[model samples]
Structures are given as C-alpha cells and as structure tokens.
Target: MACAGLVGCASVAVTDDAITQRTAFALGVDRKDLTISNRVDDGTTSRYQVKTRAGRQYNCFVGGSISVLGRTVSEAICTEVGRDGATRPAVAPANCNALLKSAGKC
Candidate 1:
C-alpha cells in the first residue's frame, strides 16, 4: 500500500512537470524562469499558480487522465493574474489568447 501511494505521488509529479513545460511554451518563456508557487490537485484535474521571471503571475489549470498503458495526456488553461492577484482571463491580449487557443489551452 505504501508503494502504491508513492507511485501515485510520482505520477502527479510527472503530470505537474508536463503542465509546467506546456505552460512555459504557451507563454513564450523559458521553463526555468517560471516558478510554481501553489498547486491544487483534485483527482485528474489540477490547478497552479505560476510566477514568471518578470514578476508576472498566472493561474493555470491542467486536466487529463493516465491510460492503462501509462500514457498521460492533458489539457491546460491559463490566465493572467490581476493587480489583486485574481485570475483575469478576460484581460489576456489577443496574441496571447491566440497562442493559447492554438495550443488548445486557455
């Protein structure tokens, strides 16, 4: 049972890493420059608070399932952080929205 719990944790870590990478790419920033400050996981879905090197922050959501074959696939939704640290998806610029749309995110 302990081993099974460890495996589950490992899988969640992998999923978080994948989502972080995808978010960095969508934001056109280096992966290393982004910091994940907070995360919440609810079964197959997860949400994150990512801060960029420039101090800009975002709220990111990722959801998907792992297949029996151990393959993981997920979709991500991200929005800029407002002055009060709230997620402001409507404030996203056209170019950013286009990029997110192309990546099947947002």
Candidate 2:
C-alpha cells in the first residue's frame, strides 16, 4: 500500500538533533520544553513520541538529512496523539503552518 497519510517514509536517515529541532519548530515550542521518546527506526525513517511540558503529546515521524551538503528534512510530520491514543493532524501556529505547507504536512 502507498505510504500516503503516513509520516517518515522518506528514503533518508533521521537525525536526533534535526528531528527534535524540527518537531519543536513545528509545534511552536522550544526544544527544552519537549521530551522525545519511543524512537523506532526502520532503515529509512524514524518515529518518535514527544510529550511537551504542558502534557500535550505527539507522534512525530521524521526522515531525510539535515546537513549542509544534503537536503534538510524535506519530510517531517508530527501528529497530535489524543488521550485514547488516536492520532490526528497537529495544529501548528500560523507561521509554522505556512512553513509546513510546502510539505503538505504538520
């Protein structure tokens, strides 16, 4: 099946620093305010569960390189995890939404 509606299916490695920073940016929060965990890697992508200081949780999927000599995370998506474990598109700030518009994900 196609990976549409899925996150982190790109053919690139996911970096901790890059993913964390991008996740925070997408959530409109500081890196220090978020706690990322439960990373599961599958060659091309990495999935992580992130919890913010305010108890908001998310499932962030990341892939692609974030280096000067490579493309910087052309595909990074984070979805909000509901209390019952269901996931939905994360609601990002206007600026962050605009930034992620090109990728068609949040």
Best TM-score among the predictions, by candidate number: 1
lDDT of 1 by residue, 1-106 (tens): 1224223432353466787787887677898998986777766567788898999888877765544456464545678878985556623455556766676444
Top candidate on lDDT is 2
- TM-scores of the candidates in the order shown: 0.66, 0.65
Predicted structure 2, TM vs. truth: 0.65
> Model 2 over residues 45-97: C-alpha lDDT tens digits?
67889999999988888766434454556345788888887765686555456
Q: After superposition, how far is residue 23 of candidate 2 from its true place, in Å?
A: 0.3
Model 1 misplaced regions, further than 4 Å: 1-14, 90-106
Clashing pairs in 2: none
